[model samples]
Target: MSFLQRYKAGIGLGLYAVGIVIGLLFAILVVWADFEAYDFQAGLSVEQKTKGFSCPLAITSNESGLMTAEISNNSTRDANATVRMMHTLGSALVVNQVEQRLTFSPGQTHKLSWPIQASDAAWDRFIMARIYVVGSMPPRSTADYCGILLINSPFFTGQQILVFTLALALVFVVVGWRMWFVSNKQPAIDAEKSSRLMIAFAALVALNIFLSINSEWLASGPLLIVNLLLAVAVLANRLNKSTFS
Candidate 1:
């Protein structure tokens, strides 16, 4: 086959692979954005009044599921606020640690974000988030605040999940068809041609590896899968050439 014909046939497969990866990422981001934040009022009860800390506002998560707190200092002086996000599962404690720290001046409202990653598996079990705050008071005293923080599940609607599954299935179907069924048999390639094809395949493998490092889905399963498909394609092509040469 001429170079032009080879390009024409390969372009569709390449596009499908790239499309599936990009589409999957876009869908996750969209779903996360839709259900990212939860507002929890803190220090409102009479119990909090005795402690001298105030202004419990909101807690939110970013697209990556990092937690953040929107709080205002109601005290008369600057205070150091330490916020913690604790994960609990059905009367069992799973995770509890400090999430963010911020210094707030009197009446200052600030949004402090922490790198708290909530795994997808957290949804399968009962999960609850509690935000705790410890603030510095005058005369070396410390005040404490605690409240429940609610974060909605990203996959609750399930639309994005369905879309991703369909797109992934389509990608597999197209790539499988080209690799196992579609014939690319030709006369035996010279050493130079074989080397070039090997180099191209190596480049594809490297690209997939790089992408997988940045994507959990690809790193976990899809990268190895597609590489296996590519290997089978190459082996089948070579076997056909050797047989018919």
Candidate 2:
């Protein structure tokens, strides 16, 4: 017998384990990088507020939308402030800086709006908005951010895609390990088919990881569903012994 025939089970299990590990590591790395980038860009010594900021999480490429921020002067004095919004793709700015200077009386709130347009490039981008009072001691300021997806489809958000990816990974990891034992007992043709199926599944996992890391959640979400269906079909086929004969 050849080496693969002698150590088939071990080899299959080892490959499955390696694929799972690599996929998980890549997923973690992507999440960590996103957090680090957001913190670096928007995590100045200023207070961050999410309540007053509103922007769509996903938009079609080359589309325009409105982003609004509510500025309130709660202090017992008139406040002069500058509100600046920056649209960026990765580390690069995608549009001209939008700035508005306003004066607010005590107990007054003003809602400001800016027109945001997505680029033709189908990628993830950010809108960073800052409000700083003019001549305030120690620089009283607040910052907020919104992540925008520049894709044709707006069916899924990043969080939804992430959850689906993780769930699919868990399912594949379990089913793939069990497949090795089943393939080991099959005839040569059936064993070859099972091996091919496993390899294809692994490749799909890798592709999903790439799309997710690049923030292509629109594509990644559907791909993950397809992968789940493929896994289910393969598992059902394997369980039916007559299919192999």
How many residue pairs clash (N, CA or C atoms closer than 3 angstroms) in each of the candidate models, in the order given? 0, 0
For residues 111-150, what per-residue lDDT tens digits would candidate 2 score against the true structure? 9887765552213543333333232312367665545544
| TM-score, every prediction | 0.29, 0.43
Candidate 1 ranges beyond 4 A from true positions: 1-46, 49-66, 88-92, 115-123, 137-245
User: Over 4 Å off in model 2, which ranges?
Assistant: 1-43, 48-51, 89-95, 120-139, 153-245
Best by lDDT: 2
lDDT of 1 at 220: 24
TM-score, structure 2 vs. true: 0.43
lDDT per residue for candidate 1 within 94-201, as digits (tens), equals 454456677888878776554433332133322234456556743232323222222344543233443454466456535633542233334446534643554465
Error at 181, model 2, angstroms:
27
C-alpha positional error of residue 19 in candidate 1 after TM-score superposition, expressed in Å: 37
